[model samples]
Target: MYNLKFLLLAIFLYSSCKANISITSIDSLISVTDDQLYENNVDYITQNAEKILKFSELNNYEKGKLYGNFFLGVTARMHGDNENMVRYTFAAEKLAKEYDDKYVLAFIFLQKATIYKEAGLYNSALNFINQGLTVSNSIQQYEKRNCAKGKLLVYKAICMSYLNPEWKQILRINLEAMKLLEKAGKPFGYDYNYLNVASTYETLGELDKAEFFYRKSLKVSTGNLKGMGYCNLAHLAFLHGRFEDATNYANTSLDYQENNSNKRYRDIAEIYQLLTKIYTETGNTAAAKKSEKLFEYYHNKENYTNELFKKKLLIQLLAKAELNQKDFEMEVSKKSRNLLVFSVISMVLIICLGMIYMKQVKSNRKTIEKNNEQLSELSQQINNSFSEVLELAKSDDPAFIPRFKEVYPVFYQNLLSRYPDLTIAQIRFCCLLRLNFSTKEVAHYHRLTIKGVQTRKTRLRKQLNIPSDADLNLWMMNLG
Candidate 1:
């Protein structure tokens, strides 16, 4: 309970403020790599990119022009500024293709698919994901190819989930993607992949599994993805009729948008719609109106931008379909049937899951208590050992060294195993050093002068043939 409250508080604090990125120079801007920028909050990157675009003479350097546009597109995508995202992506694509940049083309294709996916164009998203995979396969760069392949599989899974909603099929695809990610050793956007799983489960009303993967997604999310996790959690709360919790979570999601400057317009609009419903249901009409007005603000913007994207995407798809109408029709029919069957199954599954939820909740509670109890026991053991070791360090008794060895027997044994030539007095001195005692402290404890302690340390260092530059105290401590 305490941990849950603390987690909530931390989420609140983190979502309530914008993170400030301090890149003040053109050199700093140029040095900001894609991975670094991706990990940053949206607004921070957006503003920094704008600064560089405005102040830096990017035209003077070709690489600068390429990176600048790519960075802008990334920030725009997170911002849900689809128009700008498409524009920047196309510009970058032209330049990349002109330069015969195979690697950058793979990344660009993935980014385009992501933007299309966010814009609710699943077919286009899948097409671009396929293009990305094609580029990935052609690349001989092992790590890059693997990473791109994993990402494409995950994206394909996402497109399939939205288009088909076949939970079991989606799960299988995600499993395949996970294996690829593990092999690649670079699992970028896997959090979103987990999120897609959670969303599928939630659609099926398998609340238990949905909650499990939502938490999993939350565990791995960074930047804008973290905000999306909070939004999903808010929706889950609403599903369970936990209005107050939903309101808190929705606001937290909004805070993340505001802080990160990503401000996903449609998501924010939906959150306000949620807030309005929550407020109205709880007899807060004034608050509901306020939320409704906020909803209107973002809803209008979203509709305008989304419509533009849809029209463009439809035209693009139509042009491609002229020579493959039969294939497109077949694909559409197959996916439509998949969605229909899944929805029917989901309705039946929800009823069954609803019946079992209470029992599962009780079982989960007991399991959590047992785990907490085990954790407490392990923590206590560690604390006790630490206390004994510290006490042994300060003691002046003749048995102090023996007590120390008793408390940390493995450390003592390791030292003797590694340095068998040391004499008894030297071993005793090494033990004192293990406690990180100063020369004066060791002298006072052992009833020897400081100079005597120093001489003993020097002699021990020579016997061990320790490098002069090496920290003697650190070396002794590490022996443990």
Candidate 2:
């Protein structure tokens, strides 16, 4: 497959501008995974990943670096170290599963099973291996099938040898292990199976046959199986009373083993015991005593280490339980936080709705008050207009003033509030004038001259304490 980053770079450099370069980079990175399509597309996926790692510097490419981790994990496990393998492969598995990269997930899970097997976690190894098998079978990928099946058989063999209760089960599994290894053409696995078979034979007290298989295991194993093959051969040699051969093989195993590795203390103590027994048998009393002292030192050292390891394992298990408890608490806290956030959200929504309801209610009340005020004002205006129509119809009638004086008797009383000396005749004239009638109309209504009506209006105004300069007509209109 072509490098997705390079294609994106071509587009970025050749494009007119750099406005959407980041978005383009993300698309290109996503397209890298899209380019691979198969259940076991680990190679193309890895190649795509290498392209980004080689070219891209940003953490955006990090999400695609899982395949690299997967490969490194495989290498680490092949070198007989499961801790680093677990570290790398777990990260890779998490990333692959998140992306729904089925092929990558399956492959990494298969490798994760291998790591578990090396770590002696048989159940975990089988579980991971089965998961891989399920996914691979669903996709019908033969490569994944071969990988999972081969590793699973080896895991079964180890589990049977170490933990199986039935002797027939152990032998059946070891034989199946050899056949599976032969089918897979894995020399390393075959040599490991041979060593296990030799141990089984040794347990059965078949020394010569055990020695034959142990030597065969020693011959077939690669450089990677250094300490294992030699250690087993040296143990067999010691059992057979071949002290010099035992020492030679022990020395070779020690040379290959690391100082602080899992094999060191056991190897040291076992070699010391073998030397002590050999020196004692050879009549070398001084050498025997020195070897015995060394044996005691290494033996005590191994016992102390075993106790320390058990303590550490206890601490790890306790720490794991504590971590699980913390996780449970954290999950509870998160749920509580979610519920709290929901409550706050609900409260805010309720308050906002309440405020909105109050505002609407206040607005409705204002509208109702305004409508009532308008109705009252309209009723008053209608009453006043009807009274003016009635007065206009009665303006020409002489009984109108008499009728008005009778109907509105408080007119004189109101006039007296402003002028205590206001006369009855002046009030009548004032009442006729207040109707806005013409002087001629007022004369006809009151049976008087137009000049007389005007004179009477002036007299009425003066009695009401009117100013000579003020407009009576405007004053009456304002009063009305």
Candidate 3:
């Protein structure tokens, strides 16, 4: 009985551990699929993604569900299943947003942009590309953010080519995309970049540059991309009227397409069309007729696929439009909230500035008032000193000259410095005149007649180089 109990406990523990391991393995599978999404293995992705979705549902794993749906959407796109692609991607987008997974959200935006581009909705595609870039800004992983942004820019350039085929602008955008991808690491979609730039150079009639890029594209291409490169080269040869080279390139493209499991119908159709023209130009009516028939078949098939895709896309667009309306309303609410916050901040800033200004003004007023008080006190002191000096002079005290020199040192020094030859009597006469004393007052103070005072003034004027018309009393006061 003890052994049986231990065995039961061990079985229970093993089962629980196995279940946890299974869930962990699902997550691991999803992670691996995420990295391999950009590769050419659609079947592997679809198979693993389906398994992930099934087990994720059983285990209630959020991240597993998100990636499973996303990877499946990507595989649907590869297989040209427009309806399932939109459905799975939208489902994944909802989950991504719910979890606040910015990296996956950005990639979803990129996927949507590619969908729109494939549907011939260039403006919509560009809008999604912009949204992808906006979301990519918030991704914490440096390499992931750069890779996401680079892929978006690549699609943006492609959309621009369709909307406005300005070759130089397209070239610049493609080059920028290349730089960003290179910074991210061994760029995932470098073949597409080379292919786009090659087409642009070809359009611009830069044959040498176009050929260089075309070869570069071919060098990196695999599967459908290899066929695409050959088809493009065929078109380039056809454009230059090289019938034999065009025929060879077109045949090579057809051979690759036939062997490629993930065949691009449009590229194949384009190759057939090119072959039709090449055979016609070379005077092979039989081959031309066969090529023309094949071109019609493939071209019609491509058109039928596009029509079906557009119809499904239209339905999804309508649903998306309704969702977009809700999003628009939410955006408007967000903007209004932001605007309110900004207004509050601005008001606070203005109030702060006003307070600072008022404080500064009050400080300046106090400074000015203090300065005025100091000036008034100095003026009063000067007036008291002058009254004492005047009283000394009126009393004819012997100390009057020395007192005057102390009270008006600048005046005494300037007078002596300019005319050092003045005698004591002459200096005393000049001092009374400096005090604004009249000629009679000077005569009374000095006990001299008015003529003697006038005679001294005339001599003093000559000695000091005073103008004759200038008043002597005023000149003596103004000397200092």
Candidate 4:
């Protein structure tokens, strides 16, 4: 009960006063690679991109322009805007040339090779990777050179798996890259390479070797890399009609992928394609279409993706609107509660002021009921002391005294603390009388007289805030 009250107090305290992020109109169709992912964290991509664009506009190499445009290109690729990817890359390359930085050229060429690789142009990808490698070698950047070689080998392996697509050739090149990367002690980027090789071997109908290297790849990779490696292994299992195993592995991959950035779009697209194939084989056209559409949605180039993104943006807008409506309702409810609380507080204050005015009038004048109430309280207290002294009636007792200053004080005093105007005391005192105190008894107990108590009681009744004599005691108690 205490916890619940605290929670309610917290909600009331926070309420509608909290700073709200009024979602501005999102032009999602035009806002490609738009909102910063994980808004609470530093929007590193956006910060750097702005720096780059600012520098480029002024024809300067300010800040991290090289990395900024590279990332922009990568994001454009995810949104399937191949034209934007190329454009961004071209801008970055121009900046790189301006600096005469081989590292920048190597990086840009690597990025371009990745673009070509995604488009299924093996030779084009190799040409770009080779250019990157040449630059890496000239700079004597062994780690980066190894990275370039690893990337080139992976591209060749992928092209081999798809084009002419000799599984043996794919396996051989990937294996060679694996050994080289390991020897160079630069295995970070090439973690997925071995898994792709194993998958290729599986396509060549070598399940034993496929299983072998898949496990090997998994041993070296963890987190999303491991998730993807398992996903590929699952694909092989799906090809072998192991649906249960496939689903299990795919689910693990998704679990990891969901928490991480969606950086592996092409790989995930392939995974979905495999799932689509499985669904098609099982005669599940709806499921197959969903997977196929998802694959095309992520894998295809600019124009088609832009059309799809427009449709998706409409759906997202509807969803965001629904969420905003719910947020508004929560806000409204919070405001209503604040109003109710303030309303109660205002009413209490008004009644208290009325009681205080009556007390003043009693000092200056007198009333018949004022005389009568003290007599009543006196009689009641005498009876109570004789009947039995309640523990609460003792002056030194915790319940008898005002807990604040540890002293005996008026019933009206406690009421004034809460209402500051003896707001409900007029009616609430009647309930006090029902605790078996007469007007005189109440006065003697609280240290007042028959006339004084009666005067106060009469004033209390007059000051009762509620209209129509609706038993203000009931109303106040109900607030608890």
lDDT by candidate, in order shown: 0.71, 0.59, 0.80, 0.58
Per-candidate TM-scores read: 0.48, 0.47, 0.63, 0.43
Better of 3 and 4 by lDDT: 3
Candidate 1 lands at a TM-score of 0.48
Tens digits of per-residue lDDT for model 3 on 12-69? 9999999889988887887777777656568889999999999888888888889889
TM-score for model 4? 0.43
lDDT of 4 by residue, 1-480 (tens): 999999999997675334121111111211232224212112455554555455544543332455467557656654556667776777678777876777657767877776655544456567777787677676566754565566656665765555566667767888877766765565554557777777777778888888888888887776667878878878878878988788678767766655666445655676677778877877889988998898887676434333333333223323333454566556655655655566567886756655554564454234334434433443443344323224354232432322211211233344556565543334335434434466767786667788987686556555655444555445444433
Residue 227 lDDT in model 3? Answer: 82
Candidate 3: C-alpha lDDT: 0.80
For candidate 3, the 10 contiguous residues with the lowest summed lDDT are: 373-382
Which portions of model 4 show Cα errors greater than 4 Å? 1-46, 52-59, 62-67, 78-81, 183-188, 219-228, 238-244, 254-480
Tell me the lDDT of model 2 at 191: 68
Residue 330 in model 2: lDDT: 66
Model 4 Cα RMSD, 1 decimal: 31.4
